[model samples]
Target: MTPHPAPQSRGVALFDLDGTLVDTTYLHTLAWWQALRRHGHTVPMVRIHRAIGMGSDRLLDAVLGPDRETGEDEALSDAHGTLYATWYDSLQPFEGAAALLRATAARGWRVVLASSASEEEVAAVRARLDADDVIDAATSSADADATKPAPDLVRAALDTVGAEPEEAVFVGDAVWDVEAAARAGVPCVGLLTGGTTRRELEDAGAVLVHDDPLDLLRHIDAGPLARPPAPGGTS
Candidate 1:
């Protein structure tokens, strides 16, 4: 009988959709701010911006305090969603976001978008990304029991691609992303496009930081998404 070759090992590239790829950080911040105001809460935009990457519930907890009346949580989230939806048609992906996904796919990595956005929101943003050809899979808020800073979403994304933590790399633009990836046992690459400082992302456990998707693409070989060495070959 002829010998059979082993199956190829492929690494997974997990990416965050909002802010990391699409330029919706400020839009989210504004939406949340307006929602909070409508709910009689007056949180600062700076604080809301920093909390943009968190799930709606966590974001409310972080901004409105855990002691806040639970009765208004759902309403507040709905308000934000309504306000945010207004800009759906105008959403734009950061420069080189599609190229980065393509390049990573070309390098034999399975690219998966790990986003906390709802399915409808993910669809809208994916349309803006226009990189579905290279994306192997994508996870929405429904895929996980929890969200960023909790690791459930990251783990869900990993599961979607049948990837183990050690065989995956996550890329995002927030400290929450780094924290989530850390809890999921995957190294993360942070981007500055979402208004997060590099120091904050580094402190949260990002292995590397870049200015944005374009910057990361420019130095892809030097980051976590670099092609893995072949069997019995040097890196």
Candidate 2:
């Protein structure tokens, strides 16, 4: 079950961790590929890559098919988790990830890590980034009913930070992230660092896109994150 969220805050900057803040896109693809193969399914890495942002609950169907046996889902998820965990000690944050968070926080935005990753994984990534001092709060899979493209996680993150959707801007690296933010009525800024193309993110409704955290930091004042929070939580 998902946990109850804390109150909201103003001028929130909600961020996706995996492909947005850390360099885990290909690592996740490889882990999923290995897990699928373990169950005698041999999906290609490219197909897995495209489905990277979806939670494990939805990813198998996205890469495999809806008709796939439901019984194997848990096993597959566990396999992928175990496989992915092997790299926890080696996970690295993208360049300027911490600085970006600090800058956003310095500008009065409550920085929150809004990711679909498990809390353990989120913590690992946060440790690697070493920027928790500036991050006000975070929401993981345990805080949402669904993952990206569903809006549940994004909405949960907003609630966790006490920010209305209109008071927040989401930064992510996947089309699912943009779609999720749109569903939550928050503007999204897509990052190409997650291996997703700018065209894909923009088409999914991202108001702006940047190459990485550094690029966004360089132009923070000129982008969606710079928008002021709505007065009195109007919407």
Candidate 3:
């Protein structure tokens, strides 16, 4: 019998789950709004939407003002978490989400999830995706000193797998994600599955953009996820 070839070992593939893999961007926006309202803060949904990819510690500062009372930070973050947890069961992965992950794994890439969310939140998202078998590692808020747009989480993800910036590419759907990838010196591939637009992502440093995970999966060969050139060789 002809022997099957070994799986092609590409570089690591780091992913941001919330809006990039699952359809939770708007849900998070609504949750943040409700949480803020419950705490007597009235942040607009638009502002909250833009802050979705930021960590809870940074969200308030981004949407609200730096002048906000520092003491209320934990309470506000707790409220948001409490409210967001209610919709956990309803969270769903985007079309071809699991397939995309599995396909990337099949290419022998070390797949890791990089999220600024709490451990529970990240677990919920992973459960929704239901593709943990293909996932090699994950780094949540607890694993990082800071969050997106800071490079902490991205660097943590890379450290989890002992990968270098050039040996991996980040896939995400928000400007913060792009910024984080850039700070980590890793190229970013943006997806519009989140509410972020192509122009915004591009301006933030995404090397390429796609409509969603499925779209990216379909174009992987010709897209940013394509295998890099061999050492000392040009593509």
Off by over 4 Å in 2: 1-9, 233-235
Using lDDT as the measure, what is the rank order of every candidate, best first?
Answer: 1, 2, 3
Clash count list over all predictions: 0, 7, 0
**Residue lDDT tens for model 3, 16-51:** 999999999998899889988988888889999988
Higher-TM-score candidate of 2 and 3: 2
In order, candidate lDDTs are 0.87, 0.86, 0.84
TM-score of each: 0.93, 0.94, 0.93
lDDT of 2: 0.86
**Candidate 3 lDDT trough over 10 residues, lowest sum:** 1-10
Give candidate 2's TM-score.
0.94
Task: Give per-residue CA lDDT, model 2, range 1-235, as digits (tens).
Answer: 1223332436788899999999999999999999999999999899999999998888888998899898999999889989999999999899889999988877767888888988888888888999877877888888887777899998888777567887888999999999999999988999999888989988999999899999998998887666456666443
Off by over 4 Å in 3: 1-10, 228-235
